[model samples]
Target: MNFDELLSHYKAKACIVSVEFFPDGTYGNIRVVAGNKAHCDDMASLNHPFEPGCPYEACFPKNPNFEEHCYCCVHEGKPLHAYVDLYMMGLWLNMFLLPLDSDQENIGYCIYCYDVTPKADSSAMADLSADTAADVLKACIKLRGSGDIKHAFQDVVEDIRQICGSDHCCILLTDDEKCTCSIFAESLRRGSSLYPMARYIEGFYTITETWPGTLAGSTCIILKDERDMDKLREQNPVWSASLDYAGVKSVVLFPLRHGGKLLGYMWALNFNIDDVIKIKETLELTTFFIASEIASYKLLNKLEVMSTIDSLTGIKNRNVMNNYVDQIVEGQVPMPKAVLFADLNGLKRVNDEQGHVAGDKMLRKAASILQSIFHDGEVFRAGGDEFMVLVSEIDESEAQRRIDQVHYLSKITDDVRFSIGLSYGEMDIRAAMRHADECMYADKNAYYMANPELKYR
Candidate 1:
């Protein structure tokens, strides 16, 4: 029952460790309670062997920011065959933990360690290091750059396409909402004319919804040839049909995940090799880093959009306006510009007669009108009932056309009542803004005077 006696009966490589569980479902302190001399010699980082209450994780040197796989074994009560490489020791350790039967409520874990260092140089790791470097460099250049996302990702996909012996590779970035998952970006194969599987994008079986029969839900779904495709067809007819129609004899899909959420799926079609080992090895080498880059890009993009857009009207807000003015005024993007200042009429009347909800619809209507009129320019929801359009590098005829379009559209509906004031020429952004703002107020004053009841507005 004592530590030394318990250690004697187990394998020479085995160790007993105590792991403290936190309320957040994550393990905290991992202390090695007992181990054989051989286990201590290998695992113990210091000159002297670790005492009963010593940090297990720190003692085992690992990659920085490395998540311990042993946590899942102890906390989730799931048995796993996982290994960790102690870079300093150059020894790979395989872990197995069992729940200890102790009087104490939280006695922590009793782990068994087995070193698999001899098997580290197996043929399965064949050419992985050599292959990854070439792919990683090319992928990093494409993903990290400011090139168009699809185009950049397409280039990244191309690196893996031929490397993995695939005819085509594409990354489909997906957006998951409450009841649906939609493809946000499709980095399709280069020189491909039509999308034979385009129907599935807008069809019955979306990726996540159709494929939920895996451990991580991000598991690789590999279909080799017609029978394999047919088997999937019965499971999800639409998805299978689409795949078959595309004339893809073989396919492999790996879900690109960040944290635990699936961002999208990277897929390869009709590769030369059906050898699962090669396919898995190739994808395993590439998909992870690619997925991480994709996740960072998407999260950053979402943040940018949230900062720039008006949530209600779905138009560019003051944040965008500030950036636009700063660029033009600072001479960053020099061009002849036009500032069309627009204000909605009867917004106050609607807010007073009907509540703010109705007023919101009126504001949306006003924003829609502005967006329609100034389709070519950057339209901003400047204020509660105000809009501003910034058109850069515009000539007189183009400027007149934009202004004329606004004048003609304002008379279309009683609900969309608004006044527009434009200042267009080779001028500074601030001066144009000021002139347009003044003209807008002058136009507003004329409307108010005509309708005396709304004189205050």
Candidate 2:
């Protein structure tokens, strides 16, 4: 069909309200405005099949045959496509075909697609504008709730590519330590042969120590400027080689950020720009939204870590220790464990006579001894003046030997001391703790009886 016939067919399909394809392929210029009001205003200067260069230039460099142009392409002289698929997200059934041109002068075509949401025909344009904004917000939330931040962005990029009919989409995450970026995830069209690197740590966007401009290096657009983009391409041999292998000609990278901190960039690559515009626009909103949500989730994880762990000592806190034992007993983890109950001796006397500072030092010293002796088992500060150790795989003999070692060390240093009572059993962790406590108290009473002058309380 000729241009007019093609346009008529799409308009009737209702997927497109008006379609125009120009011989210069700049027909996208004549297509009415699309996307949200913000985006439409941001991109108002150019028609469809947006060529390389600034949007303000007029009349195709004043050429004799193509001199009527008021907007220019960003690529200057490269081929472009400007068709808008009216059927994005299965939301719209109306199609409008506007052919810009049919000859070499036609850089590309522009399509103003419509959606199926039943607003009045006159208000259809307004509906299309608002629908994308709402959908983008929802998609952003859905991705954040998925839990895996990297994978969620990858999924969104892929979904956007599918909606926009692109060949492939991928995301590059920045590695601050390495001062570089790498592809973390990608989604390629079914038949298209685009495959990104396996992981992000390998530096995929580099050249063999040369000035970049090969397809690989060209892909990294450090900033938005296209001038130094060639330098980025020249530096990445792997990326350049991969792009050539996959026949990818056009690419758009959307940098993701959270509170102005750069998280990474999402890239949409296709043989044509039209195939990726929708994805680019959709990701623009989704990226920031996803970043902010992920930041919040990670902060919560950090807080949880800090709360569950004891700062002065590396072992579990008393509260956490109780829960740990409860879980092991209630869930029936395994057999063969020991319970050790220990208390610091002479601490009250040390604080009363030598000052609390000395007593604190002695307690810390005693804690260190326990930690060093029972490093393999769970050690806990069960109370202000008491501590506990729970072990498995050793019997009463071994436990006693370990206790003797602590006793001998205390005699030599005379800095601090502990009296430990031990018990071993398969079940009833709580009862075992009680048994150890009872034994500990009996030992204390015996010591006091033998040396009444040494007793402090």
Candidate 3:
């Protein structure tokens, strides 16, 4: 066959790929047998001049996913198309593969054509088979239509598991700063022996960190058989051993990314190998929407925390304290067992003598002492140099012990003193707060009477 002539018909960069076929349905060497002008130009630009019958890796990076596609296209005598993010290259690739008629025995041939862009093209991504399009659309609807994002993610993961005919599907979120990974959502096939991912999540981020290296610049990882698993073993022995222990045979893993940030990863275990292309196609688009939604959800949570958290003291702010009081007043929540008001005894003197920076440090020290003592309670910054601690489901004796501990700790710290007042037993939250405030003032007056030299209004 005139391979170059065949490739000349494609305006996009195109090449002829030949695979060494075997009788047992396995392949040997895969090589780039020929290339058109555009493909040759690309190779030359990379300093790897086009050579006939060179191993595919000579011209392009070695990718197990690409090898699988070539083998499948040649064996099945069908066409394959894919739109993938080449994250390593910072490019999006639109690729097409079509089986070609071959004359040689024990050899198969296919035409691999592709184009690249610096950014994702929505039309190229949406170009999918009807069934795949429907599946992706369903996932998008589930992600965007639900108010509870976590529950919506659960539904989508289950749907993805069923679509892949897999035993398990999971979305694992990664925190690089904390070096931790958490299962965002997961679905396990009924009666499957596969254990939940939560069992292995402890210290799993170390294993996840190795995935990008194993993927080797591909968009995702697909291990359809033992041969691919062997490659994975060579690439990541620790993760492979963990999978072996967990009884995972075949798997597909995709990194969920949004706005150039890696949010997490999505994976399926023991899926139907015959539907690899369909599964890849469906997830390629579905993960895009999922990552976007996850980014939005995380941003909203950060905003909520900023609004309700004290920036300086690193405790709940007055807004949250007010809301809790409202909840208790309206009978929406149980009355707290104890309320304690802690006012810094000499903040005004410290600010006037030393400056506001020193005063701020004193306030932080006070908050830290209160937090350490009432670690089980809600600690709030009610006002400048003032903090509130609310504890529920605790006996009066325990509350008093905690308050005593607070006083002892504060007394021992340098230049740190607290005039603390406590109200124990169930009562109206407003009245409890008023009583605590008055008691705190009385304690403050006593402190000033004892140390008039340090007193300031």
Candidate 4:
């Protein structure tokens, strides 16, 4: 359409206009007054009419809804006329009109198009914000349920990045024993100098210097410089490596807490304030909530560890042994496997001659010996004077040789000796155990028959 006519048509609409196209197809700086739909329709029909001979006729169709003219000549990705057509369509409906090129062939349309209608209600933005928060909360809950403090922190880092619109996130956990810290997670960027997935650290000075609270639970430290960083790294090796690994000069640590105690701290890295709202307050609150979940997970993990471990020997207990065997018999445990049974021979002699204290010593010493001999196996005290072994990838013949070595060595110590019975193969472990026990009794009898004086009565 002619510049003056198009201008007069849209003048009354008060729509913002920054660019206009002239009859010569060149861009022109233009301003216009607003108008009603009829005025716009009249202007389109007068100048850029829907006639055969019009140069701009390629853009305007006989659409009654066509409003003020808008030329998309500025978008050089496609033909100028096609862009103009799309731009004119957009003006009519307040919608997106992506132009396409004919050379696209089999690749489908070259341009993308969409119609964007103004949201009638602003509350949808609020709903979107709430929905995002809920999703982040659910993700944090899933991470916490994993029973891994490190993994939970990692998931929180990613969640925070999504919520905060940042490029990366991380978790820094304070070591209660060493008073040091480490990087638990980060944006899985791969590089030798990048943030190592598992690194110990102290504190990031950027957030900590202005943090106003203890470093243990500090959040959102924007790295401003290197002055305080040296002091932090000097405090611990873990701190130094974590900082270098995360490639983040600025960091925030949120202490995971539960039941009025601090469980661990999470870290967020590479701050992007533009994407996430209230980078500090939002992250702090989010971390606080996540900490409780992480704490519960850590507690469960500790309980699991305690359940499987023998307090005295620091190995799997009888309960663990039985459970492990069930797994092995079912072929759930990885093949190949074997079992060893060991009995301490002269415990009564030790109790009678050297007293109960000596007997206890003998038991502990025997356990130690068994541990050393079967270091490759999972060793356990099955009961008094008895032990069990679960060996992976070793048959009974190989196990018998190892037992002979242990037995031959016992001759060097006159005070304590042992009669060990071994059963191998992928047979029933309980029945194999019974066979080993009978064999051990047979050996014990042979030893007493050879030397009655050596027998403990």
- Which prediction has the highest TM-score against the true structure? 3
In the range 152-234, model 3's lDDT, one tens digit per residue, is: 99999999999999999999999999999999999999999999998898989999998888877888999988977898898
| Cand. 2 Cα-lDDT | 0.54
Comparing 1 and 3 by TM-score, which wins?
3
lDDT of 1 by residue, 256-343 (tens): 7666677777777877643443555457546666787878877888998899999999999998888878987788876447877888
Q: Which ten residues in a row have the lowest lDDT in candidate 1?
A: 61-70
Deviation in Å, model 3, residue 302 alpha carbon: 1.9
C-alpha RMSD for every candidate: 12.9, 11.7, 2.4, 19.9
The top-ranked prediction according to lDDT is: 3
Candidate 4 deviant stretches above 4 angstroms = 1-136, 144-154, 165-168, 172-175, 178-186, 189-193, 197-247, 273-277, 331-337, 348-361, 395-397, 408-416, 448-455
Question: 1-457 in candidate 2: lDDT tens per residue?
Answer: 1433343444221111122335443334332222333223334544534322323223112111111111222223222222111211222233333334424453444333333342214333222335456656566766757777667766776776666566777656665666676665678788776655453335553432222222221212221223233434565646556555556565555455555455666666663444333343355445546556656755786787666655554456688777778777787555337888888878888888999888877777777888888877878877666888877678778888899988877777775667677777737777787888888888778867887888885
Give candidate 1 misplaced runs (Cα > 4 Å). 1-152, 178-208, 213-218, 225-230, 330-338, 346-349, 391-416, 424-426
- Against the reference, the lDDT scores of all candidates come to 0.66, 0.54, 0.91, 0.52
**Could you tell me which 10 consecutive residues in candidate 4 have the lowest summed lDDT?**
79-88
My TM-score estimates for the predictions, one after another, are 0.61, 0.49, 0.92, 0.56
